[model samples]
Target: MFEYISSLWSQFLSLLSSFNISSALDVLLVSFIIFSGIKLIRETRAEQLVKGIILLLGIWIVANIFSMNMMKTILSYFFNFSVIALLIIFQPEIRRALEQMGRNNFGKKLGLLNKEEEKQKEKKQRCISAVVDSAAYLQERKTGALMVIERETKLGDIINTGTVVDAIPSQQLICNIFFNKAPLHDGAMVIRDGMVYAAGCILPLTKSNKVSLELGTRHRAAIGMSENSDAVIVIVSEETGQISMALNGVLTRNYTRETLQNALEEYLSSSSEPKTQKKIPSFRKAKKS
Candidate 1:
């Protein structure tokens, strides 16, 4: 038994010796792609699909080792055919992932160059302040409002869906638009670069059944928008006068004025956003869980 262990160790050392820096980088690249794909589909219907595939693979491995020839053949054929089926089944998810990739800055900061970063930071702070103040005012009046603040992802598609306001963001403007009797009260308002860029925009509704039935259209739309883009969505409950923010498919509730302000600042700021974006590792996912 000791000799057998010694032989195994020798083979492991040989394998390690055969690997170079290029092999290490190759593994890292593959790992990053897998991680990014999982992150794109996290908390969506596609996550369940991935989980099912993992279970099937586990069963196939067991069946193959047990000499279950019929089961192995069936499983092999299923996997081979499922490639096309998965593409069809997950078409929406695939499109969304590709769209998100196109939206990213190619792992490079195009808009956030270090030279002008300080100026941009000040602007981002002002934007966060305006949004938080407006949200607080809306929350106080129970004036139902849904606002999407664009971050790294360009929301040109979403912006074109609404009436272009192109006015500076202000507490009064936000409160007035969300008033029950206002013209655009039924739709969402979008803020970009500290400006009320658009209003009366339509956002997609979340298809996941995991959301609570108690959450209304505003919250559903917020979640849906967050799922589609890397935007921070603020929602004020008309019925309960509660404030909530949705990001990356997660809905957080019961935010006070100060807490909400801090959250927006932390999330909207260039530095804080990177912490959330670095989900390319299992350790980070485990930490979040």
Candidate 2:
């Protein structure tokens, strides 16, 4: 045992001796990648998968230590084929990560640099202002409104279910679309690339059983859409005039016009800014007796 420990120590020292600037850079690059991957999947369904994978890895390590050949062999086979399994299981997350990477400054400069990229900041700001103004208008009169803001995940499928408007957003235009008596009042409006892409769109209803019974179809649909994609869904309740936002499967309610604008701006600018824990206020409906 002493000899084994001595040999291990010698190997470790030898590795340290060979480490140079290139080795340090290689370690840093790998560490950055791992950190970025974890950050990408944070608070997502992929997080649970990572936990499960870690648990299985622990079991496999223990099995090997104890010479439990059958268990070790099974886990070995599973791990050997894990590349394909990971690809299949993490498809959505992988896509999102790649999309985010492509949207970043580095990727933009590398491949997608254009006038559109240069103008996105200004355009998105205008859209946020218009949406906030419209939400305030609808909230005052208790007129229901559902707006889905497209992010990295393309919402082409959702947009196809509705009538294409493909026009610049304005307060008047948005309010008119959800004016209760309007033709598109009952359906959702999808905002894409800072334009009012579609209206009278059908959104998927949430499968979650834990949603409050008080929430109507619009809110459920908003939550459902958020669950499937990274899009931000803004909702104005017809009954209470409550303003709510759904993101990453979490529904946060009770946003005023000011708060709504700030939240939207923050989330919209997330790609350009350093990520931090910006907690939007949350509220749960009171249960009936």
Candidate 3:
């Protein structure tokens, strides 16, 4: 026991002596990277997948300790094959991660992109006003409408589903697009950088069975689009003329002209902290969809 204790003390002292400012910095950098990776995975679907992988690794360790040849062989084979499977499964997430890495915010922080961002902000306000006005008009007359406003997350996929409008936003134009009997009324509109970017676009339906049966296709599509991206979606129900807004998968309903304007203003403001995404509270809780 004394010999073992002496050996540990000598090793510990050696390690302490070798430790320096450079080593501390190296440890801090590695720790920061690990923490950031955990945060990123936690924010996405990868968290569950990572947890499953860790569980499998634990089981494999146990199997090895017990000398379970059958279990060990199966787990080893599965791990050997999992690399390719994981690449395919996490392609989207991997691409997003790479894109985020490439997007150095130095330019934006130095106000280099301020001109473009400011223009976008102005355009966004215009689009918001047009949407709010159109929604009010539709709600009053019970015209169903679906409008998607893109934010930082590029919505090129969603935009491609519809006819490119590329027109300046106006309440009259938005109302006309969704005028019930209009050709594009059955579809959705996409607003990017405050421009009427696309119309008559088809949106993906939410796969979540959590959506209420009472909701229609427009509301479901809005929720689905919001779930898939960081866009703000507005829906005007045809049947009840109810106004609803969806952001980050949550739907809030019963928005009037003033309240909807306020909600949009609150959410659409440029956040100073670009590292963390922001979630705004709803004006009012809609039906739990």
TM-scores of all predicted structures:
0.72, 0.72, 0.78
Q: State the TM-score for model 2.
A: 0.72
Whichever of 2 and 3 has more TM-score, that candidate is 3
Which parts of model 1 are misplaced by more than 4 Å?
A: 1-19, 31-43, 51-82, 92-119, 272-289
Q: What is the lDDT of every predicted structure here?
A: 0.80, 0.84, 0.80
Candidate 1: give the clashing pairs: none
lDDT of each residue in 76-172, candidate 3, tens digit only: 9999999897898777567656655553456656665557777877887887888889999999999899999877678888778788998999989
Using lDDT as the yardstick, the better of models 2 and 3 is 2
Candidate 2 yields a Cα-based lDDT of: 0.84
Q: Residue 153 in model 3: shift from native, Å?
A: 2.6
Runs of candidate 2 with Cα error greater than 4 angstroms are 40-42, 55-76, 106-129, 151-153, 179-183, 203-217, 223-231, 247-252, 261-289
Ranking by TM-score: 3, 2, 1
Q: For each candidate, C-alpha RMSD in Å?
A: 5.9, 5.6, 4.3
* Candidate 3, backbone clash total: 0
